[model samples]
Target: MEQNYLAPAETMQIHELLNFKTICMTSSKMMEGVVFDQELKTLFEKDVRQSITAINDLQVLLGKAPKLR
Candidate 1:
């Protein structure tokens, strides 16, 4: 069996980065409204979801971090 060494948190970070990149690409595509296809729209929607999930996770993680206050 091939072992996967990456932790779930690290995998999530990679996914977040890929999602971010996709969002950037789709945002550019969005500028040319008439040229976008269903696939692009789908990709954009998925990217938004991933980005939101990533943000929420990060917020929770940061909540555990030491604060100045």
Candidate 2:
């Protein structure tokens, strides 16, 4: 993968995405504690997995640091 350095705007956007992803992932995890229904718990777990994937992808982008126009 081409690891381009992130421009200032791109870096800021990535920072925002990272923060959002963190909140989403953390909320999903915390929800597991209160969720009693199996189906809902499963849903929460799925969301957590998705959030993790998204965060991972975002992290990769952050590492690559694309300067998208």
Model 1 misplaced regions, further than 4 Å = 1-35
Residue-by-residue lDDT tens digits, candidate 2, 1-69: 754688878888998999998998899899999999999999999999999999898888788665458
Error of 2 at 39 (Å): 1.3
TM for candidate 2 is 0.81
- The number of clashing residue pairs in each candidate reads 0, 0
Residue 8's lDDT in candidate 1 = 58
Report lDDT (CA) for all predictions.
Answer: 0.60, 0.88
TM-score of each: 0.50, 0.81
- Model 1 C-alpha lDDT per residue in residues 1-69, reported as the tens digit of each score: 854355656656766765675576567556446546778767666765665666566556544434345
Model 2 pairs in collision = none
lDDT of 1: 0.60
Clashing pairs in 1: none
